[model samples]
Target: MMRTIMAIVAAGLAAVAVQAAGPGFDPRALKAVAGPPNEVMVLGTPHLSGWPKDFDAKALGPLIDRLAAWKPQSIAVESLSGLQCDALRRAPFRYAETVETYCWDATPARQATGLDVPAATAEVERRLAAWPERPTASDRRHMAALFLAAEDQGSALVQWLRLDGADRHAGDGLDTVLVARLETLRQRRNEEFLIAAPLAARLGLERLEPMDDHSADRPYRNAEEEKAAGAAIMKAWDNAATARRKAADAALQSGIKTGAGVLALYRAYNAPEQAQTIYDSDFGAALKEPSPERFGRGYAGYWEVRNLRMAANIRDVFAAAPGQRMLVIVGASHKFYLQAYLDMMHDVRLVDTDAVLR
Candidate 1:
């Protein structure tokens, strides 16, 4: 009986070993390497929640320098889409892409205490100088351009006026009028857009695509409807955001932990259901008419509908000029979905974030 039992156990172990060797395993070496031909490298970018806040040029300067060094052929970015694209395409004809310049504008924290411009620039320069890999000459030139553009006090003032919840002025000049302010803001935004745009273009990227359209005009027109929808969407968005934060908080609270950031990412990916719930809620209904959430949902849906459009775009560009690397500079949120969608295609390779960042 014992001999029979031992035979049964040995047979089970053999079966398990065979089962563990999944499809594509070699009989001799029992290993598999390449995937199908359409695979491409993808990475998730964390939103600079505090884009210019928490971290400054010091942090971003090095990171971007490293990314540029990798020499990706195409860089896809999360940026302007649809009508916004239409607007951007027309912008050059309307306004001059002027000579770039940089001026120091201290933050309220620093300005309140009267910090010198050079002092702030010094801090920025110090951090940038610390980058492990010396930036390529081109990348340095780009950074200098960005710093200059960001420092333009006139443009900076325009951006401040565009802030969503800022108080309205009582009797400001034409410069402060909403329309004028928006134009300035839009131009500034486009200039900032160029930071990633031309670089990706240089790499022979398939093409740059925006995540969604901007409906800045809609909210104010149908005041009643907009308010209703805005309220609803805001409520849903708030609740959903809260739930997400709670989940993230819970995960952090748990003693068993990996990287908090990674866990936050998983939570974001799994958020579609939560988003769906938001859509199903009153907020979704409100947004359907004149609310920005409608725009937001529509924006998100476009990417979903045109799934693998990036790879297709890349392929099209490659057809025109083959053998060039591609870079995509998309918002961080789209990275997870983009990566999964890209993985389904054949022969693409995803750059490992851990490998790249470390």
Candidate 2:
């Protein structure tokens, strides 16, 4: 009986070994050569204030320099792709608005590529349809240029990547094309001008990836309840943290000309205390929306939907290749949730912003 038991155990071990070696797999060899695990650092940031705040784009230079020093392979931002030209062709009405939005301010692309929105849209569709297995740098340049004309920076971004890694250079027409669109781009209301896009340019990255999801906007079931709940929440925010938060933001914006000032704000913004206090005070506090119970829960649910979607998008960046460093620059309110969901991922290792700030 003992001999039979030993035999069965040995057989099980052999089966396991065989499974591990299936189809040219080499467990030890693969492990030895595998690159480092993917690392992500989510930088919690205040969205640049518009209007009377006098958000000087040049003030963010120090902050941009620090991020460029981090040397990430790809940078993902909170934006979306442009040309779903393929999908739009199949269902024009469904995507008519998208084309219109991209086309509305696509003057820079028209000036550069001489293609209007409809013309640029057709070119994107045509190019993508006949995309080659290996696109030449010239081929990529034209496609990237065309996507820019269509105002699909996200789609234009992918075309930019099609070039050889070393061939991605600034003022190559595609990279520099958006430079001319800077003033016009600011009206779009994003932090891209302040940090993300400029940092990408400095780092010689092909394009920025937008990972924000808005598919599940406002999940609250009761409108009357939601309105009341929103009011209560706003009152709490205004009553408690409004003055202090605004002061800090003002100071940071004013002093960002220096690296020391930027680093101080960076460290403070990413502090655990700040995250905990905000979560406990704002998102955690419950009040009457429709019913006291339902409103808070609904708000939390919507927050979860947004963060989970954002987290999934970040994860997708590392799906094809691990060991890539990604930095997610999002609203400070989103930092804790993004970190929480991303931490749960098996292959994801969250880099300590505290260390980087130091």
Candidate 3:
């Protein structure tokens, strides 16, 4: 009995020593050094900027506030980064065009800071590296303005990386510290413009992970062939799923400020069962033999490649910080695919959109 007790005590001491020597045990860890389980919430939002002129950004304020409450250490939006940056640099004009089309251009930022893309990028990188725990309103203002200056709004991300995921709230309206125009540009398509980007800017995060990838898309044999194939795919749609998706979006927007409605919307959007619905409804015609040359397969193939690459990009963010809370703001159509792929990652823990909404 004495020998057995000694063995047990020795084993306990050894276990404690191992933990003390190595990084502490994290329950969320799936592999060594992977860190704690990352809490991820993917919010599927509509293209609000593309909505009608009467689109109410104020109505979406409550949802943004509630999401900010999650205190996410990282936020990923459906924007392209890495190789895409190369493409944007090649076409600097689109940088501005993208802002005008997808986001409201913040001319005030240029006038206020007198910093263009290159200058702003350098300044932001410098400031963020030495950022204080409590940034001054000017620090926050310049950061916000920088979001407008990057070639593809990449400057905002540069700042986010430097701030170490701090929440930046610059105020509201003209009294607001960060230019609303710059803040809107961070919002991709209209999702970030009205919702995600504001949350990011307010939290003072350095940059958002650009998870949308499109390098997989390529032209078919000819433009004519591609058109015919597209026509066939569209013909198969019969507008059933498209119409439903649009209507659902409208309903979600109507009650976006309420939080519950939007939460339910995200819950349904990320549900596993939603996959078959997409295959049968949205891409039902898209993956069939629209042409003798396997056009449907072409369309489906590109989609598969795009989503796979995007999932990989999203997953890559976890390597740097495994214990982070990540919030992904993407199109409603992407939620199912993004969630499915993320669910496969060992270190990722997808927060129930429904629960978060509740």
RMSD of each candidate relative to the true structure: 17.7, 11.5, 13.7
lDDT by residue (tens digit), candidate 1, 1-358:
9999999999999999998886663332322334323223444444434232322223233444445667765544443322233343344332112111111222322332233334434543564567435444333322322222223232223223323333333112112332343333333433133234433433433224333222222223467865665565565455554575457546533421224343344334334353444344333444443544465455345445544565455445435444445555444445555656555433344555544444
lDDT of 2 by residue, 1-358 (tens): 9999999999999999988885564332332326688889999986655423544556566667777777778777765444333334345444455444423355677777778766887877787678877677777777767867876664455554444567654443555656434334434345754567656656755557667765444334467766787776665555345566677678766665556666677778898778766665567654333454565666677778978988998999889667799988888889988988887777777888887767
Worst 10 residues of 1 by lDDT: 95-104
Error of 2 at 168 (Å): 15
Prediction 1 global C-alpha lDDT: 0.40
lDDT of 1 at 220: 35
For each candidate, what is the lDDT? 0.40, 0.67, 0.63
- Ranking of candidates on lDDT, top first: 2, 3, 1
lDDT of 3 by residue, 192-298 (tens): 44566567767767666668876654445567886887787777676666677667667756655544555555556666666676667766657754567666677
The best candidate in terms of TM-score:
3
* Higher-TM-score candidate of 1 and 2: 2
In model 3, the runs with Cα more than 4 Å from the true position are 1-35, 88-127, 141-149, 152-189, 239-273
